[model samples]
Target: MKKLFLGFCLLVGFTTIAQTVADPPFMQDTADKYFFEEAAENVDLLQIASDRNKAIKVLSSHGLLLPHEKIIRQDVQYRPLLDMKLVALTEYQGQFVYLTNKAVLSNAWAGKLYINHNIKTPKAMGIGPDFLTMIAGENDFAIFKNNQEVWRSSINNLNPISVQHDLNSGQFLILTATGLYQVDSDLKTVKKVFEATNLTAFGFYGDTIVLGTTNGIQILDRNTFTITKMDQKLPWTEITSVKNIRGSLWFGSTKGAFKLRDDGKYDYYASKRWLVDDQVVDLAEGPDGSVLVLTQKGMSKIDFSPMTLAQKADYFQEIQRLRHIRYGFTSDLAMKTPGDISTGYFHDTDNDGLWTSMYLAGELFRYAVTKSEDAKENAYEAFEAMERLTALPGLKGFPARSFERDGYEVGLHANGFSEEWREKYEKENGRIWQLSNDELWRWKSTTSSDESCGHFFVYALFAELAPDKAWRDRAIHQIKIEMDHIMDNDWHLVDWNGKPTAWGKWNPDYVNGFPINVGDRRLNSTLILSFLQTAYHFTKDKKYKKAAENLIKKHGYDENANRPASVIGFVEGEDLSNTWNHSDDEMYFLTIPSFVNYSFSEEQKEAHFNAVKSHWEVERSEKNPLWNYLFALSGGKNIDSEESAWWLREFPMDLIDWKIDNEHRKDLTKIAPNFRNQTYTEVLPGDERTLHLHNGAYRNNGGSDGNREYAPYIYLLPYWAGRYVDAISAPQPE
Candidate 1:
């Protein structure tokens, strides 16, 4: 019996070892990189206090967690001395380094520092910037800022405050422009560590420090204040930088990057074969320990990972970085797949709203940076997919909004049209609605037609920003076709091809159709004014002027008698029976001033601008996050100071448990799990709650309205809020 028990235990041990050695999907040598994002959050912080050690062992093998006192909803909430200006200010060990000027800090001794406004009470010890700006130790932070000897610390913030914290409790070799110094609790005060004439930069692994100076490389020991030289030919140029990786010293020069192993040998690791000027701007370690090299030309990758990690980055880089790779998209600049379109690659996330937003913003980011390879590559791929969309014909002169996964036209309002699909579409469910001839040019019931489409404006914005003039021409040509060809003397824009059926209409506050008796004011606004204003933003065309001017003059901006000094309603006309209002009233309020500012006619400009501001003052609640985002985008005078953080407050405190909400309907409260693939009623709303985080859009297990990534608002809100203005241009997507 004892032997039998021993045999069982032996089998268990073997199984555990086997799991540890389980082969990854790809080989190690060819691996490029792997993402370790949110790795810490995936750890079970909800584990029992008794099992804290087990929790630590299981959590955070990669990426980083920004050192929090407690965990909320499995996400770390680090209480810092400064208020968290951004959601992601971090602490490595115990020594906290503020990413934003005002960041949250916490200590076992002091509680928390709250941020009332932009002003901070205790001026950050290192208010400006840090050279070796990484959080290295548990309670220790290393900043090579002023003098080589002036590193700062927060040893007082720790719980036990031991001299032996794995990361924080370590020696700091400060590198100032003047000289170097070392501060230690072991010593009475900060003492002179070493002296170097023109020390450039340095990185610390532990007590050992590698310093870059005008004289070359000097290695210093913390306990003894002794300096030694290991490599006589250290790569130290005017542009050289230092880092310690994999327990060995490394350096980056204007020409290339090199590494030193424990076996007393240095090798040239990173260099550009396709070089222009060969000047390295920055070098940092990526998620999977790949050598990240930033050069004057663009970012480059090094393929050397551990055999267990990836000896060659070819496979790993391809597998891990989904951001750079396209799926089901054959057309690529590098190489074309058999079924790829003529333009280029297809999609990283297909054509979902989330993917569209990311692609749009990312494209803007690329253009803002001006010709970075990452930006170019991403834009190239997006343009290709969008271009293919143009190939799909329009219904009643407007392109269909979306397609089925099979690449067939499934537009509810796109049966007969000025443009037709490449492949013929047959009515499968008999749910297809065909438009009537009377609706043509009248802008009524757009079961499918593109007279005054708001979404067309979004499409227009992207089309205008496209690098290809041909693509831009096509987008503009479409607008011309609608404005010149379809817009008849009656002044209505829609030519409804779909048959009038008893389908429910949508409003900002109501999801499904309320009652047939209630009227719709939004559809007209979305179709008419949205398109004109968007065209103005894009082409600055005088042709769009005719349609927008007519609407403003006739409707009183809402359907009242005369053009009033004050705008009555944004969405002017609709059947009161449908009970629909244009939720996008904000679009008019935002774009009016912009249009006015751009206009040569001063009277028209002020009239529009003044009307927008006056209406906004009355309409905007100033409290809702969505309106706050729009208010900021409007670039108005007498703005609210706290409006910026108001947007941040809604940034989904727990990204994991992100609740999908429609807010428009109570019936479709939450989507159900196991829902995917089936689009346009093919998949039930109950099916949308699958744990899918494709790109950043996610809907998991019985959700409604496909919140966030699954929703359309997340990307638009941030873009409108001017979040990327610091990184790119403001007021509009490029």
Candidate 2:
């Protein structure tokens, strides 16, 4: 027995220390980037300015600014300027100058407009602090002072693309297809500073010139005109534009737009969430520190400002609205092509009750914390769905996996059944039901242990925390019926065939037969103990306590309580324990609250607490907000509050389950896959990893073609749990 305990410890130690380095700590002040996109196409230019405490977007032909609004109609009143085909728009000495083919019109808020016709049909233009304008044409360029051409020069074999002025040094630069030329402030000398092939765009960053070429981005020394560094890590090779805003460099490519951080990494923003189109034409800084990206399908404003807790709450509120409206409370089905459809209707999942139970649990927490009527209503609705599952199959206590209208016969397999199986599933035996109502409800059969765990877990919460007596009584009734059914059937969930389901067995013979080192024995022991404790707590049944104590004393289940936590990764010669089963992990964690909160005695509570702490210690490295929050609620210390907040803030507001692939990202540090198929990285998976079930947000590589929207409860559960336990402060009412 001592050797068995030591072996379990060694197994857990190996899994815990598999990663060489810990993930970077999350800071509270980290700014979150928000995306806003419009659908109008042919947006050639973008400009930003502060107007009346708002960041107004000035397009080549129109201007408006409203951050919260998703769409802006064409007829709404824009800037005071007349609608015209303008060549360029720029800021000169705190005034906006709109350039046309024949003239330059400068406007100020004081209702002043100055038109200058000195330069003819300029291809590109720039304005200096001295109120001088530099204009460049196809083969000619000139410097203008006070609306008059002061110096003129002719160019050969160069088609000028743009003109720019350095605000710090007051030097002007002319960017052409083949080379870059610098013009003296005195307008006397024009020198060819750098030569590069297929030059597309250029920007000044301190003493270096960042050049965007067809191949990659090149950094050149301003004085020596020599290439210093080449960055080929962009998602796409074809560069379109580059802009230096406040200290970070924003790169626009044919595929997407990304910001180069000070640490020399990229935060990519693409897809419909960030842009209507991937082709970024230009970029400009808004007055409120937002980035305006000009693309083939109009403008997108990206705001990267730090959000206060209240602001985060508000954002979550909006997310709740969208979630309910588009992908309302339902089981998330598996999809062959995610994001291609409106919702996960491709195929139903076997864990529908389990998923809905989790969402129901989240709403219960929300109601407990905020006392919000809407949350209570949602919880009740979800509870009704759960309650209906057991009654639909016409079994006294059996809960089906899910239910759907009749004629939705995609998942049923009638031909493969044997004579014995058909006897159980026959219409006369009550295995399936055809409701007499207009909607013929047919329930899925052969429910698994995963669903049972979710049902009992939430049933306990509902019985204890429900606001009304009816809900509490209903929860108690469900618990009694399920527990009675399990107890009478020799501690196993019998399917419609009167045979034990594969994973729902917890009989003593089956559980005690497995090797002590295997996870199933330990998992079954923990779950049965939890169920017995919960059943006794609400039903006041001594038989449940008697059953629990017999397992602990006779079968040594107490010693096995921590054994599951000690073997989270692979074990030699044990196929079931060779990989991390996130489904099992969910079940394990979900059982802890009941196990500890309603234990049989002080000793039993202590045992459960130790098991929770041990599990949390092994899981801390994952930085899962749900795990950390649950641990805090279970009285574990060293909870990662800041990391929890980071998870909530970084969760993509767009919950469309879009296809995300980041395997080619050079900025990430990848470790070899562990036994659980998890690749460790320096940052949280939620930020870079592919979306997967029971996985942290840090997974990096996977793609989906169909839309699999998750319930907002994924976020709400942790958020409200953090609030309930005081791990996070509640936001002030708006």
Top candidate (TM-score):
2
For model 1, give the 10-residue run with minimal summed lDDT: 14-23
The TM-scores of all predictions, comma-separated, are 0.37, 0.77
Q: Rate the local accuracy (lDDT) of all candidates.
A: 0.35, 0.66
lDDT tens digits by residue: candidate 2, 62-178? 443333344433423435344554567666554556666666666554534344545555677888865677777767777777767788876675477778987765778889878
Angstrom error of the Cα, residue 85, model 2: value is 7.3
Model 1 lDDT, residue 580, Cα:
17
Candidate 2 all-Cα RMSD: 7.8
